[model samples]
Target chain A: GESVGLHLPTLSVQEGDNSIINCAYSNSASDYFIWYKQESGKGPQFIIDIRSNMDKRQGQRVTVLLNKTVKHLSLQIAATQPGDSAVYFCAENGLKGGADGLTFGKGTHLIIQP
Target chain B: DAGITQSPRYKITETGRQVTLMCHQTWSHSYMFWYRQDLGHGLRLIYYSAAADITDKGEVPDGYVVSRSKTENFPLTLESATRSQTSVYFCASSSGGNNEQFFGPGTRLTVL
Candidate 1:
């Protein structure tokens, strides 16, 4: 099955610069998308989420852009900090019914270079 | 003290042995899910519970059993452990179908 995938496995960025992570999903039925950050030895923590009706959403220091036409999703971290170093994953909530589950991408490891 | 938690944080067992992983959440969320994380596979859902006494299979449910008698507890049991089952297991809970899910620290299981 053609599932959600990331263009890069690892992304390197300077401590004070901006960072962007890209994800591509094949399921056009996915109307909801979410970004999660998992630090070392920790579970995934929600970063931000966006709906198909909107093109962009912003959080404390993160922003998610959804391109429904291309089935592409991107997470932008402003003023990237060392704490932002972690594996970022994008999940699509397109499943129907009560037993449905989200489809996740392989994830992109974000490394903050000091 | 008030979030989702998984038991035995770490577990190791021999193949063919029965193993049960425990997941508990204090949020009292209506939805609970189990997922296994492997090298190539990011995260695959094992099972999910919509509410008390209601459960369903997810991406991979073979060789596994799940029971959700209570809303806050969802336990995953492996009838016969296998080396292929060695992976990081995570439990998550959500308020609703479209809500964001909160995951536990995860359980690293090793089936020798």
Candidate 2:
């Protein structure tokens, strides 16, 4: 079974528009969640993370929102740009520092339009 | 390099052959993990090690093997390559399972 999965396979947005990518996780015990961005020919790069204790965490132009009640997480990107075009993935780990590696979502491809 | 690196950015092998992919990190992180990515599927964990000689199986560990004899090196081997094994392999490390993982460039392997 898939522990995490994205709501959309691909998203196209115009430049300067705010973009939102959604993910659903089934692990009720999951405490830590992270979003990663991967460019062509590269591995996933860390974007932002949120713990179960918080509902939202904001980074530079990026915000992660966690809804434990619904078991959903979302990444909001402000002012989409060409450079922001990439695949976004959400990962979850129940133990903060345990050996249980993260389970990743299939991913959403974000395409920025001029 | 000061971060994690995977050797042979690309590889092609035949069925029933043995192949090993190498991973090395200079950060001396306490955790190392191997993941495989294929089209339409998320990266799946194959194996991981907390420290030297302390390895564990991940979500998709079948047909693959890993060893962590040293803190900085974790190698993944395929005992018998199959066409289904073709995918991009990534190696990642973190101070612990809780922290953010730093991933390598990845190795694209094709089993014929």
Candidate 3:
């Protein structure tokens, strides 16, 4: 059974618009969460990560918001571009800090419509 | 290359055959992991090693074996390949639990 999953299987956004991808987790004890961007024919690449203690974290053009109260996580890409089109995955590391590896969700395919 | 790599990017084998996938990382990370990715199921961990000679089972470990005799290499073996074992395999390494895990390109395995 998958403990983490996305709200939608696909998301389409205009090239200049913002893109939001959402994920939900079943484990309340999970502490660390990560967002990965996986381009076709390649492996998953780490985009950003947030710990349970933090509610939000931002990177270059990506922002990750964690809502522990609702057991949800989201990744927002600002001013999406064509190169941003890819499959995004959300992963969780339990209380052990991921010594056992990460639990990943199916993923959400992001399409940048020009 | 100074990054993680997997051998035989694509492979096809028959059922009941023994197959081994090799993973090598140059960073000498302390932790290495093996995962299988299917269409519907994202990445599911098969086995992980904290360090050389220290291995543990992950979410789905059946029919798979892994050994980390050296810190830089972790190989996964399937005793008897099955059709269900056909999937893309990925290898990842991290310095520790809290660090980011760098993944290999991936190996696509098909069992006929």
DockQ for every model comes to 0.69, 0.76, 0.83
Tens digits of per-residue lDDT, candidate 3, A30-73, equal: 88899999999899999999988999999999999999989999
lDDT of 2 by residue, B1-112 (tens): 6699999899999999999999999999999999999987789889999999999998889999999999999999999999999999999999987878899999999999
Candidate 3 docks at the CAPRI level of high
Question: How close is every model to the real structure, measured as TM-score?
Answer: 0.97, 0.96, 0.97
Q: Order candidates by DockQ, high to low.
A: 3, 2, 1
Best by DockQ: 3
- Model 1, A1-114: lDDT tens digits are 657889999999999999999999998777888899999888989989888899999988888998888889999999999899999999988556224667899999999999
Model 1, total clashes: 0
Worst 10 residues of 3 chain A by lDDT: A93-102
- Tens digit of lDDT per residue, candidate 2, span A1-114? 548889999999999999999999988878899999999999999999998899999999999999999999999999998999999999998433347688899999999999
Provide interface RMSD per model, one decimal. Answer: 1.7, 1.4, 0.9
lDDT of 3 at A45: 97
- Residues B39-69 of candidate 1 have per-residue lDDT tens digits of 8999898998899999888899999999998
- Clashes in model 3: which pairs? none
Ranking by lDDT: 3, 2, 1
lDDT winner between candidates 1 and 3: 3
